[model samples]
Target: MAASTAQNTTGATGRTTTNTTIRRDTRTLPAAALGPENPLPPLLPRNDPHRVSEEQRATLPAEMARQIGYAPLTTVLPTRIRDGYTRERVPTAVDVIVIENDRLRATVLPGYGGRVHSLLHKPTGRELLYTNPVLQPADFALNGAWFSGGIEWNIGATGHTTLSCAPVHAAVVPAPDGGPMLRLWEWERLRDTPFQVDLWLPEGSDFLHAGVRIRNPHETTVPVYWWSNTAVPETEGTRVLVPAEQTWHFGYQRGLRLIPTPRWEGTDHSFPLRGTYPADHFYEVPAAARKWIAALDETGTGLVQTSTGALRGRKLFVWGAGPGGRRWQRWLTEPGSAGYAEIQAGLARTQLEHVPLPAGAELSWVEAYGPLSADPAATHGPDWARARAEAEERLTEALPAAELDAAHAAWLPHADLAPTETLHAGSGWGALEVASGGHELPGTPFDPGTLGSEQRPWLELLDAGRFPEPAAGAVPGPSLVSPAWRDRLECAPGGPLTDYHLGVAQWHAGDRAQARRSWERSVAAAPSPWPLRCLAVADGCEGHLDAAAERAGRALDLALDAAAPAAPAAALAALAREAVPALLAAGRAAEAGRALDRLPAAIRAAGRFRLLESRVLLAQGRQDAARAVFEAGFEVADLREGDEALTETWAALTDDPLPEHYEFRMRPS
Candidate 1:
């Protein structure tokens, strides 16, 4: 789908400019299809175990302390893991919306979580952001399927986002500067909040202005997290500058510490390539200082991002110069792609904390993206203060703080205007929220026309007073764990399906006993594998390792049985992955081997399965066979950030140094 709208602007010389355009188009790139999401329910808790130092925690104000770590996710229920994507790349067409003026062009991917795919400076023919050559999905996202590069809007917890591989609604609207604006809006599931991003390029202006708004329509306060992460090309001389003397450093060791800026560990860490490992630096910008961060190249010309006062924090994340970091970089995209670093702005001082948003209230801010030019000597100088001052002055000259404030004021009223034309359609979940809660969101409407199959059961529960059960062997729908949904599920008549979903909701609410009873009733009513799997998770959470292993094995067998086709092969493989680990934990190595042998040839041939195969082999005392698994060159696309399982497994196999392909350690030993 393609549509265009142009605005004519009269300049000071009484000349009319007629080429300010906002249009929708398509771009074909070498991309991998993000296949289906895992069908099984998330039975375990998904708490963030990242540690913070006492020094870091002591510095937090009262309000920040109260809001930090609030509403930790019990499970990623209702959202599923997207592990079906492989490393295979083919030419695929992706939807893009271009917001352009005479000076710059901002191309956005609405179907891919409203990511700013490319920011081009028209005058210099330069791409300001790190535009990836291929769209390869990786396991960096909270719900899986994340690609590197460009600017991404992360709204859920401390990972990439649940919507990293999903879509959002997009439309064309009027900009505050009388030009056309491209609007992207979605209902964030994790926080149950509605948010919108408005992108526009002022006529002949150098900056691309973005106005962001997040609303909490509930009667109670909600924990909110928002970060705009921008990826920029990193080179030997590229330096990141922010007006700060100190920072909070968080490494993969899972500890945060206060450290001096620019120079650390006998090297200037602002140059990303100088570091030996991946890490995060949350710059402690003073309250009165200008809120801006800039990344300048060797010539002192690159991108600068400046926002209003509401967006308070700035951070720099580097992949570093280590081979493990390099392997991760190559894994995310093409091996030959230029290295990149992330400069991020968030509401909290660090991504580990979440701020509180009052009920019936909204938070809004304006950000400007444009080119910055400074003296190479000053920006790359040994004096950190001098480099920061130079960058700040250049940013002020490019886009004044007062002008950005004025832009925010001008955009407040326009943010409530209805979208003029729809460009793309997203999921039906937002409309279901609107229909259930009767939320009066004005500008970003959740039209009933957008509802689809994923939301049908919940819609029936809302309208018909019963949760409709699907036919046997049909794929299960997502689980809703909110209080309102729980109340509805509890009030409905009990059955196999109702009891199963009710158990999930109860478990998320921390009512373990009731959840167990509900699942037991579900199994009694219908002896299926899902509820039994839930019981296994409960058993594992407690210390009943034997019972957990037995239940897990049963679930795997039932899921894979031809008579009971409850889940797809991908979901069955996920079940096997979990069950084999449980069996190994219970000292049932021979049973784990038997389970692996029972799997279909194609399912057992996956990369993740190959890693599991090595684990099973090691448990069976077959060290040689286990070593061959790593030598076969398999990649675990879904390997988590802090997971050291691969390294531990390899160490057990041999005493030699870990190989480069298997080395993904982000921290020092």
Candidate 2:
């Protein structure tokens, strides 16, 4: 059987065919007995961030549209049709509603182009499909895409939730090879809630396909965590393995990689988990797979969990490493592998990793799994190496590097500005006053507040050139919400703000024109805080750098929010300083100036990470202040002895901040 190439259906792992179009009960088109081709004109490319089409959701059918008094799927593609769900189920919040096939008309399996939400599968293995809908986190502490390892009590009947399926914007492009390919159109206009989708694997075909419409219909972002539940059969006798760079081991050689803490738990990778009592739990998977397979070392029960999902890489426990397994079953009954299951709390994407997709952009996570052993040909050799690399490339879109860059730079556009109106409204000079013509200081960075008692003593100390001392206080520390809450609300990493962060992927990978359009999509998807700050900066860069900043900033914020020790204040200092220059370059001088004035002077005196504070000093233009800043904090002694980007930036500005070795070490020199 040929697997679907996404290029077309012919030669796809299975022999497949799309039967003649079935007219909707509503579209009285008896006369228009549609030919093999679609009657509608091809849709425009969906690039608008404000529209659902761009988010890539399948639309409602003509019948459902008429019933609802509005047409759908007009903007999306690979429509849903037929009446009454030919399948059924009941989906309470935690449980899934399965929709099975009675007439064999439905085709949705991992490989059938179903676009399942998890990361692993077989039966075509192209994409994973799910019967679960999107879930949200009502509380900041919990993951939105929650999962339950309890046995599925009832795969209910009567189609749990009624659905309106129709053709979406994606069109089927016929390849020259005579195989049919799908080319999605009008993706920007088809937005709405993501619904529960099911799978139906035919005995012979290589492809099964389905899609969803995750829309942000409002001007605001729609926060969500999608969960997937699959029923992978359980076998026996096989071992289990969790993939990750650092793993914790437990019973029977079971391994897991978790966030290390003072007191750690779970089986780690380096250790072996050998036991016979039933065992199941959660653990971290490696960040890189290189298409590597964490096999169970048997004929039928060797695969435990795999990385494979279209938008999100899935984590599964296979009966022999079944599909998308969660905490319940990672081992089979016989000894080969175990049953497979999909577990995710929507803490993020494909798995429980907490990945978010900005409003207008698409975030895809790809992973692949099949049979393998240490036998070189399949396990440690060319074939294994080749497939592993290929799989890695598939999910690279969601890799931490690029998105991390975007998220870190998310709030960058307003870094240089003071948070209050006083410092900014009075001087248009912004950071220029502090760093003009190589005369800026080399102090670490700091943001000032409204000048309160809390910051008063520190300011005095900073003015006197004594830094970082204020933070030595016993009670209120980095965990304390900076008493400096001056109406600064940013997007929580996976929250509504910075919803446009996902747009970077499209821009980065698309063509020039596509990139520019995606840039607009990026801006449009950003949170309100970003645009407000950008307006505080300038409008031009708002679409590019500012957009990038919003993504990066939100990611950084999420990281900070999820951070173990949870220090918002330290993150603030770091996030703000990095944001300053970008905001300045973006031309939001006023905003930049406002933020600059907010730096706590104490950070200035340390001269170590003093760039933030030094920025303010340079602004004061007290040559002594500027020089003092240049001389403070973070002893990267070899590199001007500082652990501050601002210091590095300042040294680069001051030429001799350490000249002789300057060009040799500092970048951007």
Give the best candidate by TM-score.
1
In Å, residue 94's CA in model 1 sits off its true spot by: 0.9
- Per-candidate RMSD vs. true structure? 2.3, 26.2
**Candidate 2 lDDT, tens digit per residue, 311-401?**
2222332211212112122111112333333322112212212222354433222222222233322322324234334333433432323
lDDT of 1 at 590: 98
Could you give me the TM-score of model 2 versus the true structure? 0.26
Q: How many residue pairs clash in model 2?
A: 182
Tens digits of per-residue lDDT for model 1, 341-376: 999999988888887789999999999889999999
Identify the leading candidate in terms of lDDT. Answer: 1
- In model 2, what is the error at residue 128, expressed in angstroms? 13
Q: lDDT (0-100) at residue 341 of candidate 1?
A: 97
**What local distance difference test score does each model get?**
0.87, 0.27
lDDT of 2 at 11: 27
